[model samples]
Target: MDFFNDHKKLFSSALAFFLCLTLVICILPALDNQRVIQPLPNAKHLTAQETRGKLIYIREGCVACHTQQVRNIDMDQVFGSRPSLSADYALNKRMSFLQNTATLMGSERTGPDLTNIGARQPSKEWQFTHLYNPRAVVPASIMPSFKWMFIEKEQLGPNDIEVSVPDEFKKGVKGKIVASQDAKDLVAYLLSLKQVELPSNIPVREFLYKSEKKEAANSGKGGNLPDGAALYTANCVACHQASGEGLPGAFPPLKGSSVVLGDDLELYITIIMKGYNARVPEYGVMPPVGTTANFKPEEVAAIMNHERTSWGNNAKEVTAEEVKAIMDKIK
Candidate 1:
């Protein structure tokens, strides 16, 4: 009893010492060691306009609802070409010790991921309209309208950068909705969110779930066809939608599209080989679909064949030889 009483404080000190030693031995090294930072193969530093836009993006809390990550999981299939790497955000850094520093890889995804949004939707006009009134472009969108970033002008001057608000969206407003510099900057930032050519080391590997596996199986890839449906799902479904009826006023529908049903295979091939910027002031841009997805001639042929046959349209099926010829000619 006397020994216990005498050594009680010593025992408590020893226990505390061991706990602290455990932390030092186990936790400190993990916390202190910095992960190797490498730039992506095609990663570029932000331009001045993009930098300003990024600042605005941070200020507006756009990250609250949207995520900038494309996790390497089955659920993130529609996010980007490959899963996000730390190099993607390595260019983002603090200006000073006092200024705010943030990594915009948000926690939740109330809205769709914006990691590769620039590649998916590159329309400046659409971005402006969507920002001014999300419901104007997307009737079912739950996103709050950022109308405050715009002003109602009596009429757009020749020098003015106009926001193309459709007739249905302009319910009672007499003047035109013109985007302010802030809105433009914000859109600029959003457009800069595209992932560039990923480093060769980090290649995307497909992970098919049970339902997706069934869908792949039912897509009829058994014969000479190159799994066109699966290809479409991986590369085209996000923008064009599963129904082939794309988002109205944003992505054009392929269901009845003349381009998809046209007899001119060369034109179709050209569009796929070289990206299309509609520049119609409303419709979103289509990135070079085939090139972006790294699709080969056979894959292109398969995709074209599927597009021609499906969705109630009857058109001639494309062959790999024809696609290869077109691709070679274009090159």
Candidate 2:
């Protein structure tokens, strides 16, 4: 009380001076630079739509459910890649003055880190369709579709900008006049998900996991199955007994099957794909697990080709490429 009473004038003068200094010296400086944002490595040059998506990602709070980095010592190796370095990020500008700024950097990983996703999932078409509708491929995905990202766009022509549809997608593009920019940008961002820092523990070969350049698997070439007798013994011996007599009411005999030598190869292909469970009610149903789905398309085609040409039956030999082309549609 005594101090305040004695220096009332002095205290008032000092408080006013401090307020003036805060506004003029500290606060005003921030208004110029605004918020300085730094991007992760490889994202330095962003497409226009990708840049928009980045802001949308922040706005929608996607970071709440997803993480962007995995530690070397963590148990998340199965679902994620390795940890990240700020140096790996693509800085818009040199950040030598981080010592002088309060950056907008946050570090909380709720969902999987997106650092390696673009490279992990290679198909841009798949990603776009997935974003448009996640429930289609993954029966259980938590991510929401940013459908607004796919608005129509135009291209600049000689005189001015005009809308057009390219020749390739013209057939099934629903005859839409314009293309989706959001899809293009989203694909750009997704492709940027290359993991340049894969650890040594990860294998050099895997189609399902890991980010690496891969040539498409060849599925159309002819195969090298064993001789007719050997293939019959290896594949058909269990169902059709060695005596050429099938198990009664359990398995149908292939010794006199008509479909084996049928004119329609599609029927044979269909039977192989859909497994013959009920058609041959006397025999249990054949499984529908596709060869291209789990095993290499070639392996399945080889077995089928061998089956159709065995047990006193002679049809055509199937090629992996033909099976692959067929699976392309079925898949």
Candidate 3:
């Protein structure tokens, strides 16, 4: 009481000094902890093109709707193979020192996570179409168009790299959609956003616990028969939908489709392994979803079976061996 009354300024100064000390003690250790992190084994520095693309990504405010992170908890595992670690952003931190900004690890997730987008959706054609008009490719998407990044050219010179845009998305433009250098750079950056494989000790958590449990329960009948329905739900449900009815004019419906019920299993396998470019004018081209998703032969077989069985379409179940044989023959 005496100190407060007689030495008010001195007391205030001491309080301020302690508060600052506390902050330093708390913050300094955290900063030091970040500095000690090492990049993952597969993590690499961005190429010049990718760096320029990263700049474009920032300039376009992509970080506002999309996140480049996969968290350890919650629903993040659906976006990536594993939970993200400090090492994942080590390169970003190093670059930030020279660039005067930390990282664009976004806060919102209105769009899907980009941490593993390269591995999940590597199709350049798909990326270009999505950028031109998100709704054209994904009918229900709320993402705004980035058509300005592309320009319509009546003819392509020998030196020009052609960009494939579906006619429906072209908006009556009477020429090929040529991606500007900025668009090319942005795609390059997006393609560079693959998640690095972490060490065995820090393994990716199994997000498909239900599938694993089902497999375990059915192990007695067969050696872990892949849950086709579960696999389809995890992977194919997004594009084809839960009802197996794809978005009209955007994605082809898998329900009661000749392809899903087709006797030519090899064709289906090939389509899954290699992507389908606009085979039909009315629908958007299907990207190499299986390839990007890293679906194993067994998993692919399971997915095929699920698609055939569900939506009132009955077809013979495909085997892992059959899928493998088809994959090997094609490759």
> Candidate 1 lDDT, tens digit per residue, 1-331?
6657778877987899999998999777644532566566688888898889988887898989999998878778577877787678777777568774546899999999999988766667668878978876566789998989988889787756777665676777788777888998899889888888855677655544514343322233223656788788766765566778866655677888899999887889988767787787656566676775567888888778777778886777777878889899886
What is the C-alpha lDDT profile of model 3 across 1-331, one tens digit per residue?
Answer: 6666778777898999998998899878868877798778788999999998988998999999999888776567778878777788887743554675456789999999999888776766567767888775576899999989988888887665455554566668887777889998999999889988777887666543333243622222123457877777766655566889875644678999998899998889877877787566445566677877778887888788778778899877777778888888887
Model 1 ranges off by over 4 Å: 1-35, 136-139, 153-160, 164-166, 175-177, 201-255, 277-287
What overall lDDT, based on C-alpha atoms, would model 2 receive against the true structure?
0.50
Count: clashes, candidate 3: 0
Q: What is the alpha-carbon lDDT for the whole of candidate 3?
A: 0.76
Which runs of model 2 end up more than 4 angstroms from their true locations? 1-44, 47-49, 79-81, 90-111, 151-179, 198-331
- Taking every candidate in turn, the Cα RMSD to the unseen true structure, in Å, is 5.4, 16.5, 5.1
Off by over 4 Å in 3: 1-31, 94-99, 159-166, 203-267, 274-291, 307-315, 327-331
Per-model TM-score on C-alpha atoms = 0.72, 0.38, 0.74
Q: Alpha-carbon error at 241 in model 3, in Å?
A: 7.1
